[model samples]
Structure formats: C-alpha cells, structure tokens
Target chain A: MNIQNPEIENNVFDVRGLNLWYGNDQALKNINMQIEKNKITAIIGPSGCGKSTFIKTLNRMIENVPIVRTTGEILYHGNDIFDKSMRVEELRTKVGMVFQKPNPFPKSIFENVVYGPKIHGIKDKKLLMEIAEASLKSAALWDEVKDRLNDNAYGLSGGQQQRLCIARCIAVQPDVILMDEPTSALDPIATLKVEELMDSLKQEYTIAIVTHSMQQAARISDKTAFFLMGDLIEYDKTEAIFSNPRDKRTEDYITGRFG
Target chain B: MSAAKLEFLREGREDTMLETDQTHAFERYKVKIDSGRIERRVRLNNGLKHLFSLSTVFALVVLAILLYRIGVQSAGWLDLQFLTSNLSRFADKAGIYGAILGTVYLMLIVVPVTLILGVSTAIYLEEYAAKGRIQRFIKVNISNLASVPSVIFGLLGLAVFGRMLNLGSSILAGGLTMSLLVLPTVVVASQEAIKAVPGFLREASYGMGADKWTTIRKVVLPVALPGILTGSILAMSRAIGETAPLVVLGIPTLILKIPDSVMDDFTALPIQIYYWTLDTVLTPEYANLAAATIVVLLAVLFILNSVAIIIRNKFQKRF
Candidate 1:
C-alpha cells in the first residue's frame, strides 16, 4: 500500500534559519532542510549533536521546557507552526511523537492503542475498534496481539511494546510522525522489525527519525540529514550521502574518520 | 659440583650456626600456650557483653502486660445487647447505641467531604501546580496543620462555625471541626500516594494528546487510587476516635435517639464513655458499659486498618 503520490507537494516541512537555545546554552543553530511528503527522513549524528532536539522542535514539543527558546520558521504545509495563531494542541495532533524507550501506558493493549483516538473525542466504539485494528496491523502487531487485546500492555516483549507505541501514534491519524531513536533500545531482531515497519509506514505518513546508528539511517531512510554541533551539515538522498557526500565533514563522519 | 662442595667455606658454617640459634629461640616461644588462653578469655568476655543486651525484649514484655491489663478490665462488659441498645439514664440500663449512631453519622459526613477535598488538593499540588514559593508555602502550612493539636481545631470550629456562623452545638458543627482537624493528615498521605505513581505514566498520557485534567482523571488518579483510599481510611479511623473536638463542639453526652439532621444534637461513642467514666457515682456497671464501648471502638479501628492493608496489598500485586 505505497501511497507515495509524486504529484503531491514534495516539501511537507520547510525549515529555514531555525535556531534554538536552552537558556545560555545554544542547542541548534541555522538548521535548514526540506522534509518531503510521505518519505522517511533520518537524522544521524553523534551523541550530544542535537538531533533529538531538532526533531522535538518540529512539533513544538521542545517549547514545553521553561528555558527553551527558538527563532526562525518551520513552515508545515506553507503555514508557520510557531505563529501565535497556531494552536499547540492542534499542532500536536497533526504531528505525533514516539520516544526512544517503548512507553506504553499501564493499561490493556486495546486501551493503549485507542487512547489517542478517545482523547480526540472519537466516542463510537465501532469506529474506535476499526482504528485500533488498522493501527495495530500497520505496525505489524495485529496478527500476534489481536486475540489478547485485553491483556496488560506491559506483558508484551520489548519489540511488541515499541510497536504498540507506534500503533498508538498511528491511531491519532497524524500527518507526520517524529521518532527519537525508536530502535536504539531494542535487540537486532527487534530493530530489524522496526526498520521494516518504518519502510511500510512512510507510504502513508512523513517520518523524521533521529538515530545514532548510521547503518540504520542508511537502511531505512529515503533522505538522510547529518547534524554536528547543532548544525545541519548535509541533507541529501540517503545513498548519495553515504556513498559520495558533498561535504568533507559528512564524508569523514560516514567513513568513520571522526564522529 | 663435588669438587666445589669439597671446598666448604668456613663462613658458611658460621652462617648456618646463626640460623640454627634463631630457629631454637622461635621454637621456645612457639611451645608456649599462655597467649592462646588470653585470646579465648577475650572472646568469652565479648560474648557475655552481647548476652546482656536484651532491653528491647524487656520493654516488649512490659508493653504486653499493659495491653493485657486493659483487655482484662474491659472483657466482662463487652456484650451484644450493650452495643445494640440505647443509652439509659440509669447506669445498669445504659447502652452505646446513641454514641454508635452519632459516630456513624459523623463519619458519613466527614469521610466523603474530607476524601474529596483532600484528594483534590493533593492532586492539584502534585500534578498541576508549578513549583514556586506559593506551593512551597502551602506544603509547609499543611505539614504544620497536621501536627496542630485537635483541641485547637475544636476551638477554631467553635468560633467560626458554631458561635459566629450559628451552626449551633450540633453534629454538623462537630463533624466539620473534626474534618478540619484530620484534613491535613489526609492531604499529606494522599500527596505521598500520588507522588508514588511513576512519572512515565504522566508523560505517556500527555503524549497521547490528553489535556491536563483528562490525564489526571484517567491515568494519575486510577494508578494512585489504592494509596489514596488507604490514606483516607486511616484518616477516617482517626476522625472516628476523636473526643476532644466533639467535646468542645458540645456533642451531647446523653441522647436516646439517632440524629435526624445535621443540626440535631448527637452523642459520639467517645463522649458517652467519657461521660460514664466521669459520673460522680461511677459504678462497676457504668465502668462495664464504658469498657464495652472501648472494645467496640477498638474493633472498628481494627476493621478500618485491615481494609487499608487489604487495599495496599491488592495494589502491590498489580504493580
């Protein structure tokens, strides 16, 4: 079910001159990139390189911190998301986020999947059930967990928990999904499963993922962006960036000369 | 090698003699057993010191004796009829029914109101309020209130709700006073329970796009409920046994009928016992009645504590 419509707008998020500061410490500086619609964009960087911070800023989740401040524009479908007219709650619904660790709510698996829809006022049980089944199937967990949906979510394995979290995000029907090192906490087998899920998910939703694994970024992303010291060093096609990067720093990092 | 050995040096023999002399001196000391006996004596002395450290056991024995005395004195009067019948003017006919009714009525009012107010205040402080001087002040004041004597609270209730507001000397006034006296304890306990809920649940709820109040209502409260209920039950038990506050609020000492309204005069079990004990001509019969009331109060407290323990155990199992 590849839903990549090439005629659709290529740039879903157009970030320009974006800068972020946490009190006296500057975390992001002059980050400019174009995130394509219905494509997976992976941000790869070393530790403390602000990849997570940059993705968090896309949905204004970083602004919840008291000392965080941002300058510049993040145009989501040609509208500035940071504009005063923008409702944060609405923006959050449109741009959902999944954390690094698998954090399913301490509830039944069915309840965990349907929590987002219920909060958005989807009261009809049939509709909620349909959405939950669709989401679980999309995350590649329906066949395994469909029969025991009433069981506690914590009873699932680490990979299943991560997939459940993904299902929860998909249930909200968000336009974009932001993942912060979604597979970093999983085993190789679980990581492979998540990578496969990401490949299928990009057909329906734009994804911005921050990962420390360069191999994972190259394997799953259509486009790849490299960040260092809070700066977007290079943004290009994943194969091109890995094989023959234009930037000397990007080449050095990919070739393992220095982080 | 044989030729070299044949030329044994005189210096070597002198060194061997010196080594043999040192060995002989070491053997002389090694044969002695006096130091071994000294070590054994030291160990015995330490063992005797440890054997005398039984003060805790003695203290426990004294406590058991005191409890036995109270239990023995109160055992004869604890009859079923003494609990079911109403208080009579004559000492022989007196029963704890009026006091029991009053206590029940007081609990009916105090339990629900205090639970709601206490849990809400705790949730607000734990979940919604921003960290600042005002929140800190409120927290400190609540801690102080929990320690304030119940008699002082009774005085406050008398002035504020009884005389000035003219609620009159009724069960309503007494219940409200006791509620205020126990509110701080409930809040503190509930706050601790709310705090025990993991931070990840809150983040998970917020991540789901639920509003703050909705998150609290659906996630935080349910997870913290067992702890909150435990605290509320303990607080209610404390409220039930309170005598001074009711005394100050003028809880009637002798009433034949159950309270019909909040404004009606009522006699709690503690007040009834106090009245019987203080009668100028206190008889064995009256003492027996007081003892029976005491036994009933203890039973109620035990039941409430057990309920709290059961709830806590259930929550532990789930977690």
Candidate 2:
C-alpha cells in the first residue's frame, strides 16, 4: 500500500508493499520491486524463501489455497491486478505460468498446445491448428513434434514434455511469462535448451524466472533479485548482483560463505 | 632428535598402521557373502508366495465343481420352449418368459436412478466436500451402509416403497427397492474411481484459467468415466441377482403374463428360480427347472462382470 520507490519508468509490473499469509503463518513479507519490459528477470534464493509464492501471487494463482490471505498491490501495465473491478480470469490470460514439473493434459499433443486458446473461446479449427504450429515453433518444439501432433502428450520424454508446457503457455499470446524453476526437473541438455529459448523469448515477452541455481540466474537474466527469509535483500543488474553485491549478506551468498 | 620426540614418532607410526587397517575393513575391502544363507532365505520367500497362489487356485477349483453340477442338471431342460413358454403348474410346460420381461423393465428404472444418484453423491463428496468433521462423518456412514446386509435394504424398500407409498407389488416398487439395495455399492465404487484421478491433471486445468466446476466436468469426469462405468456394471449385476428384497416387497412369484409396463406386476429371474426350487418338495421334476434357471442367472452375472472389465480396460488413460 505504500510506495517507497518514487521513480518510475516503462516497467511491465510495479509491485509495492506485498504481504501474504497462509492461515496464520506469514509466507511473504512487505516487498517492493519493479519489472522491466522485454527482459528476463531472475529471482534467486535458498529453498523456502518465498520465490515460488511471490510469482504465484503475481497472477493470483495462490488464491486456489483455501487458507491464503494476501494484502498487496501489483500493477500490471498500470492496472492493479487485485482490484475488484479486474477479473481474475482476464489477469491470468495476460500473465501465464509454467510449473516446475511437466504437466501436460492426458489429451493429444495438439490439444495441449491449443488448450489456452480454446479456453479463451477461439473455435475455428484452422485457426487453432495454425496457433498450435506457431506456438510450438516459438517454443522450439515444432520441428521435433510436427509429424506426431495428434499423438498423446504423455508419450513424450521429460524434456519434450516441458517444452510442450512452454508451448501451451505461449498459445494464448500472454504479455508476461512466469516460470517456477522450469529447469529443475530437466537433464542438463534440456536445461540448456530451455535457457537458450529464454534468451530469444525476451525480445517479445516479459519473463520472470525463479531459480535455485545461482549460475543459472547469472547466465540468463538481465536483472537478478536475491531474497532471504521473506525479505528482498538486493535487486540490481545481474552482473553487479553476482560479481560485487552491495549488501554483505548478498556477497556472502554469492561467494558460498553461507546461504 | 630428543628422546621424548623419538617416542612420539614411534607412537605416530603405530597409529598409522591401525588407521589403514580400519579404512581397509570398510572402504576398500569386499567382504565375502554366505551364499548358503542367501539361498535359504530365497527359498523361504518363494514358499510364502507359492502358498498364496495355491489358495487362489483352491477357490477356483470349488467354483468349477459347482458349475459342473449345475451344467449337467440343466443340459436336457434348457431349450427354446423352456425359455418362451409362460410359467405353469406342470414342470414340463413351465417357462421363464415373464421373468425375463420383468427384469428388463426393472433395470430400465433402476439403472438411471442409481446412476444419477450414486454418481452425484460420489462427486459431491470427493470434489466439493471440505476436509472437515461433516465430510468425515458422511464418508464413514456411507461405507458403513455399504457393508450392511442387502436384506436390510429389502426391508427398507418393503416398508417405504411398497407399503407407505402404496405401490402394491408392482414392477416399479420392485425396481425402486433394488435401486436402493444397490445404491451404496455404486456410490462406494464410484468414489474409488473418482479418487483415482491424478492430481496433476486437475492442477493443469486450473492453471489454464478454468473454474472449479469446469475443471470437474471437462477434466475430472472424462478421466473418471471408465471407472464409473465399471462400478455401474457391478451394481447392476448385484441388483439383478438379488431376490429377498423383491420377495420382501411382495412381488408375485407366479406371474403368468409378461410385464408390459413399469406399473404391471412382475417376477424376476431369481424369483422364478426360488419358486421352482421350493416346488421340488411337491414334484421332483421342478428341480431340473431350477437348475436351468440358475445356469441362466449365473451366465448373466458373468457377462455383466466381463463387460465391466472390458470397458475399464478399453477406456483407461495413461497420464
């Protein structure tokens, strides 16, 4: 509710004074940050530091938990996502999410890619096929899966499944993509492929990734935010945050003194 | 070197020898295994597994003997005339035409009633019910009801549908009674099926901007449908084989005409077999008629059970 940072720019999201609780226990404390447009922002922290919870709160996906209560204001494109006048479905359509594990539906691969567009009321068959191909192509999956688009998505390997999820996320043409450790479940080869995809994806979409690997954050992100014990310790350019952190705690975490 | 330093060096050399021996025992050496002891353990494990399998075979052998006895008795009497002719006082002139029609009509009523009520109850409990005291209470009571005697459900049907509602031993009354008798079975089976759906599929639906109800209808229902169909088949088989409930409802055991409507009086396959078996005390020939009817009833049950398994296997989806 309080804005500590007075300066503003063409940021995609302006989050301020965000606090969240599950039942009686607080999960995320008062936090403030700005997310720039067309750039990949990485959130790095130890386990249970509220990285996943913070991204879930961005699209109100945490509302699925029966005991969750949040008091915050996240403005996406200058409109408050939590405002009563804003519908949650519309908010989710603009901000898509990919979970840690690959979770394709039991349906065919083509169905998985076009699920978002179908849910949003796109009914033309030709349009849906075109969307599926374009989305798969964008996720770097079309060449590998084009011949077997009608097969069940579950038949794919773990790496391919993750890319299918990525294709599903982009099918709806969302403005922002939020990934919660999308590479944690993948092999090193698949992890590198997704990391390479993220580099090119930032030209069109605002990307926010939560990662446990400090090197992954250093490798892919334009900006890096370090969180510890429900607090944002530092947020700066990726190089400065990793090389010569301003906060002593951030320096210690980067140099492997402690987490 | 001084004398004390020399003594210390000698102690260090001895400690090094002990450390190497300890490390060699755990980290570097491969201890010999006793193959004789391992062989004895494997034999004991296999013995228990074989015992369980033998028990299963023993039960099947008993079933085979019973079926063989009934098959021999029914071999001469099972014919087209035996199936098409109406029931008669003379054993040679009797048939099961009326019972077959009665069963078809009864199922027409019981199938829809049980399916709608049973499946709805399962969905409400599994998906909508909160994890609280009320949900737990309902779940325990439902499972307890499943284990209660089918004859108790018959008594309930007799008192409520037959007497209180004044339906008067009609096919409707019998059908309604059978539905109640099988309702608990259907509900329990459907609950298991719905619970078996993967959690990740529901999460995927919800993450794609679907509401709770939409997720249930579009994602959960399709995945759970095969299991639901399996449950319904078993429930119908249970209903078809049930007799005491219809008897308690006061359905006539000697209907001469086929039931043309749900409101018409009727008798089912089990009731026909029961009356014929009872008549064997007066005339020995009636025993053959009873055996023939038993063979038909068993065939129907086996077919129903097989259909359930086939449907389950055909529609099962891998996630």
Candidate 3:
C-alpha cells in the first residue's frame, strides 16, 4: 500500500492494543488502528465479530452495561479518553453515537433534534432552533419535515426516523460521530440517502461507522477496517482493502468467503 | 354368436344396473338420516345453553331483588334534610353532618399524602433501585401490606398513630392511619403504570445524552402520569369507604359540629350510619337519614371516578 499521505499522521483516533471482555467472555481482542480526521472509517465484519462493541468502547457507551470490562489505550486527538480525569458525559458529548435502530423519543420532531443541545444546557430558543434546522439539513431531513416541527417523531417513516436520529446526534456538534449500523434497518433507497448524508457529514466530522454490508462500507467510507474474532484483520484505504487486501482473511471476507 | 354366451352377458349387465340403482337410493337415505340426527343434536345443545344462561339471569335477578327490598325498607327514613343537617340528640332528628365532614377531612389528608408517597416510592423502585435482596424484600412486604385486612390496619392505627404517637382521637390521627392503610395499594398501582411505559422511550432519551433523571422526568413520568392518576383515584375510593380503621381509632358515632382542625375530634359518614342503625327505636327518620347519607357518599365517589376518567381520556388523546 502507498504510505505517502502525511495528513494520515494526524489521526483523530489512535487505538492501541484495545481489549474488551464481558465477564470472562472476550468480545474484542488486540484491536489497533488509526482513524483519519475528517474522513468516514467503516468497520465491517460478520455477526458477533465485535464490530459494534469496538465502536461503543470509543465513547465509553458500553460502561452502562454491568459486567462489561475493558483494558486498552484509546487516544482521541493524542489524549487517552479513558484517563481518570476524563468525564464520561464530556467524552460522550465529544464522541456522539447513533444506534442501529432509529430511536427518536416519543416527542415532537423539534424536541427530538434539540434533545442533545438541551441536555447540554442550551436554553436560547433561537439558537436551539437554528441548531435544530442546521442539523436536520445536514441529515437531509429538513425539507420534508420543516413545516411540521411539532409533529410526533414516531409519525415519520422509517427512513425519516433514522435521519431524525442522525439530526439529533449532529445537533450536539460533536467532533466524532459513531454509528452502529445506521442504515441496516432501512431499505436500499433510504440506505443510499443515508450514505450520501454520511459522505457530506465526513467533510465536517470524523465518522466511525460499523456496518454489516461490505458494499455499504466500500461505497461511503474513505477508510475501511475489518475485524475477525475480536482482532483487527486489516486497516487501509477503502480502495486498497477492497481491491488488494493485505491479509488473506480480509480478502476472504471482502470476496464473500466464509465470514 | 353362441346362445349361451349372449344369455350370460345380458344377465350380468342387468344385475349390474339393478345393483347401481339400489346403492344410490340407500346412500340418499343414509345422508338424510345423518343430517336429521345432527340438526336435532345441535338444537338440543343450543336449548341447554340457553337454559343455563337463563339460570344465571335468574340468580342475578334474585340478588337484585334482595338489594331492592333492603333499599325499600330503608327509603322511608331517607330525606334531603337528613343528608344536609347535623344529627340531633333525638334519634328521629339526627343527621350525618359531622360524619360527612369527618370523612371528607380524612380523605383530603389521606389522598394527597398517599398519592405523593406512593408515586415517589414506585418511581424509586421501578427506575432507580437495583435488583437485590433488599429490593425484593421491600417488594414482598408491599404486596403483603396490600392484602392485609382493614380491621388489622385499624388496630395498627389505634396502637401506632393513636396511642403510641399520642395523637389522641383526632382527624390527623385518623388520616395518618388511613394513609398507611392505603399506601401499598397506591404504590403497587403506580409501579404497574410506570412499568407500562415502553423501554424504548427511556432508551431514546439516554441516546440523546440525557442523564437518567432527566429521561425519567421528561419522558417516563409524563407517559406514566395518566395511569398513575387512575390508580391513585381508585385507591382513594377504597380509602373513602374504609370504616373499621376509623372505628378502631375511636372516631365517635355522633358529633353535632364539623371538625375545625386536624387535631380535633371527628366522626365519618360510616360511623354516623352505624350510630343510626344501633338506635333501638329503629325509627323511619334515622333509617331515611342513613340512606340519604349513603346516596351522598355514592354520588361523591361517582364524581371522583368520572373526573379521573376525563383526565385519562384527555391525556390519551394528547398522546
């Protein structure tokens, strides 16, 4: 692989020998990779391969679950995120996440978008409205829903609901956005829309996406990381990994061999 | 052709035709017989079911008749004045004013306090408390308390709030006792209401980076409020009808004046009716007064329930 991009040196996330366990059952083992700044990095692996767990650990979201244990060093912009001084809420604000399913609160569409900002103590109505509008625009849902901001979010279509969730995350203005299969629950058309949105969002935010679809990763991501049995199999540019993978297992996974 | 061969063939053809006709006739008769039997059986079964249903109606009618007879016997004494005026020294002139005031006073204190304590306890148990032996024990005790007899609670109130606390025979003492008596019911009901709220709503709030308290405040509580209110109202209705505890707490059978303070002596509606029934003369005036009081109490209960239903409907429509 061509290792000539000096910009890659300023990785937003520099993971080193990350390991995770859920009470003696190892979920992630020895994952090491560098996620580039202002680029979308997609982690693709088969079911039960720790792709989701690895992403969750980035924001310390897994800490909420009892019996979950982790031993690792994850550097965010060269600072260890798991340090004692690091607050989980602060870390979460910096590294936001959208779940696999669209989970908009049973509230108004406007409320759903502004939920994050409100939690952070943003009380100015005008500012919140602007943020809500901008975030929805970024998620490509503003046009369809701008006229009905007060409508219940559950009334939206599945794809619209997913976009609303994305808008909610974006409203917080996080530096990094972590998505765990954001489009897996959507149809092909909705998936394409989300992929396009992700592409646009990468220009402003560093995105780490965990997807089950290899084609989706290849289509939307600038970098691709493949994992197998809780181990990082390969990490490279999207084109190189898909076309000329360095590891046999990575090649096999990309070519539709046994996952 | 030989004559013998032709004769044998003709005979076989004739025999086959006759047998076919006979079989067709027999099949028709059998079908008709089976259908008739099935139809008769179904009719008989339907008739038996009707008879059973009629018997159930008869039983209900008998119960209604008994209720009506008792009501008729008591109606002669029932009158508007008997409900509105205070009880007099003479059995015929006595009214239920003090009892009504006492019941109202007791409920005013019991309902609000019980509601607050019950809803808070439910929220704590359902949302914050960890699953452990202590939580389990508390849960079991709460369920047990709900099933404890009212008379036992009355005794408890007599000992704990009345004597032990030295509250004396006061409205405050009675109200506090009733609060304890009805708390378990309110808590259990509110807990069920809170549990009815979908988990997804909580998850959505959490995903938006809201803390546990904020999520519960903004999402869970609002959604569960209607159910909690309905449960609380039902529990309050039960509290209103309670007489054993008040009797045990030494609520007087009659009082000329309404209670002016929580520390003052009081009488409830049930105690007044009991007092009227105990009068050896069994006069029409006292009996009618008791009936009128019963009607007033029933009316109040109906109004409360209707209000709860209205609130529930309004909330559901909003959602």
Strongest candidate by TM-score: 2
After aligning candidate 3 to the native by TM-score, how far in Å is the CA of B235 from where it should be?
A: 1.4
Q: What would the per-residue lDDT of candidate 2 be over residues B221-299, giving only the tens digit for each residue?
A: 8889899999899999999999888888878767877788888999999998888888899989888999998988999
- In candidate 1, what are the lDDT values of residues A181-242, reduced to their tens digit? 99989999999999999999998999999999899998999999999999888888899999
Label model 1 with its docking quality class.
acceptable
Among these predicted structures, which one has the highest lDDT?
2
Candidate 2 has a TM-score of 0.88
Model 2 alpha-carbon drift over 4 Å, by segment: A1-9, B1-54, B314-317
What residue runs in model 1 are displaced by over 4 Å at the alpha carbon? A1-8, A257-259, B1-63, B317-319
**Model 1 residue B108 lDDT?**
86
Q: Each model's TM-score?
A: 0.86, 0.88, 0.83
Best candidate, DockQ-wise? 2
On the 0 to 100 scale, the lDDT of residue A100 in model 2 is: 92
Q: Backbone clashes per model, in order?
A: 0, 0, 4
Question: What C-alpha lDDT values do all the predictions have?
Answer: 0.86, 0.88, 0.85
Lowest lDDT sum, 10 consecutive residues, model 3 chain B, at B280-289
